[model samples]
Target: AIDTVKSSAATWTEPAQSTTAAATASVDAAASSATDFMENANAAETAAASEAEASALSIGDYITAGKTRSQIQGYGGYTDIGGTILTIESITDQTITFSIVQYSDSGYAADTVSAKQITAQWVKNTAAFEFCDDTLDGKGYGTLSYENGTIHIETRSNTNHPTKLVLNEDLVGT
Candidate 1:
């Protein structure tokens, strides 16, 4: 009886250790998966923040704002430099009916978007909303300025494809 008991004890201890190790491994894997999911969720939201901005803005209120380099994945990033908001007429889902304000540079009262130098609206597009142009990621859309909360997009490259608008960062949906 003693011999049988000793043998059983040794065998049981090995399986118990194995079981514990397996459980530990499973728990670790689950934790890793959960962490990955949370990271991906946050990344997805940041990437799609621009879309959310487009849907929730008023005319005159800037759809695009701030200075950030345009990524080259889409159409072809607009070589933005940076500018201030001037005036805005409208920024609807179908049309960004801006009230085109005059972006001041030195003594230039003339309007039209500057080259990729006037940094504004890092993410603006027409394909998702207008169904016309791709991303229009060519040159600087223009220099935008602000006048009493109204916005203006002044650039020489205003084409038929209505530029899609991106909302300011503070307004992105959480």
Candidate 2:
């Protein structure tokens, strides 16, 4: 009877040890999975923030109160250098309108020059805007970049002439 009891007890102890080891393995696997999920989620969030920072300017942001208008002088081109004013008229969700106010820099009140309205739309995949109006006369497009309320704009002609404009934080009336 004693021999039979000892054998039965040994059999039970072996199965019990195996069960404990299996439970430990399951717990380790679950912990590893949780850590992987957390790491993946964090990486995804960081990527989203980076994309947002690189996003193009929104027209609505330029049309808000106390941020309505900006005036920039042109540079880098013989026709536009020191003789032009790029006046920001208004910005819509799909379009931006501005006027190229020209002046005769020859120190004479000679002739009357009209302001030309140039309208443009945002270009796909380039993060820039393209002028489709008659005012450009086959010149190229414009691109805008903003940071901390300061805006930088560049208009490039087809001949590779680039006119740069910088807008500071002071608000101007339309």
What is the lDDT of every predicted structure here? Answer: 0.40, 0.48
- Candidate 2 collision pairs: none
**In lDDT terms, which candidate is top?**
2
The sequence of per-residue lDDT tens digits that candidate 2 reaches over residues 136-158 is 33445666545544344555555
Candidate 1 lDDT by residue in tens digits, 31-119: 99999999999999987886665554444423334432221111233444333332334444444443322232222223223222121
Candidate 1, residue 122: CA error in Å?
20
User: In model 1, what is the error at residue 100, expressed in angstroms?
Assistant: 3.9
lDDT of residue 99 for candidate 2: 53
Worst 10 residues of 1 by lDDT: 165-174
Q: What is the TM-score of each candidate against the true structure?
A: 0.34, 0.34
